[model samples]
Target: MLVKDIMQDIGETKKKDTRFTNRLIPFHDVCSVSSGDIDNAIKSAGKEYLKDGSQAAGQKFMGVVKIRNNNTVNKESIINSIGDIFTKNHTVDLNDPDFTIIVEVFRNVCIVSVLTDYIKLRKFNIFGLFSGGFAEPKKSIHKDP
Candidate 1:
């Protein structure tokens, strides 16, 4: 299913300087990567991420991230590489759980969310999480309220 499909409408309202409103879906709009453009974005970011001079984890994180907008991320090949990245090291969940990865999609752009979670986070201020999910809303997004 698409990310927008699961998002529950939270009604449109103004926040700060922008007229903001969300289709508030089950998943947190902080780690989503739209299938529409993420193919290319994944490729580009993955290359840079792999060359960041840090130890690669290689954990093959497979799933879809939720978000409010999809226009702030590079769409093309970032997601695909990140998914494959796990297979090389497999330490993604054990080490880099902070900066909760999320994606926001809005027609022409994909906004990746470097999320801050109150649980299961290993690193703080790591808001530059280079992670994102597909249109599918995993169980994590939808929780019983």
Candidate 2:
């Protein structure tokens, strides 16, 4: 909600302003890394965004976006774990997914959410949207050599 309002305000401004904010990424839930909290948080968020009957069976494409600041957490492990939750029902489309599961691990906590327009919103970067820059090239989970 707050991000939406900020985007609207930026849109209303005639002049492009780049100093106020840099980015605004929203999350549905936050939890500590201990006691399987990360898994629980992602599970809860998945239920809300990837509800059954939302699309035809096996037709929904989902992707995972993970950013880890904590060295203790393995990025691939987290991404694969989250992917396990929806793999049975959806296909993986890193280039352009219908829904994206975001897992941000910072120190001892993790923030999780599902975003439908992550790519369309310039990956939720306020500055990118305001600057009218070219859309970023599609990203893949695997790094290309």
Q: Name the runs in model 1 displaced over 4 angstroms.
A: 1-36, 46-48, 58-64, 67-82, 92-99, 113-145
Query: What digit string (tens of lDDT, one per residue) describes model 1 on residues 33-129?
Result: 4454454444433443345445433322332343343455543345444556434533344222422344446555455433323122212111211
TM-scores for every candidate against the unseen true structure = 0.32, 0.75
What is the Å distance of residue 41 in model 2 from its true position?
0.6
Best by TM-score: 2
Model 2 TM-score on a 0 to 1 scale: 0.75
Candidate maximizing lDDT: 2
Would you give me the overall lDDT of model 1? 0.34
**What clash pairs does model 2 have?**
none
Alpha-carbon lDDT, every model: 0.34, 0.69
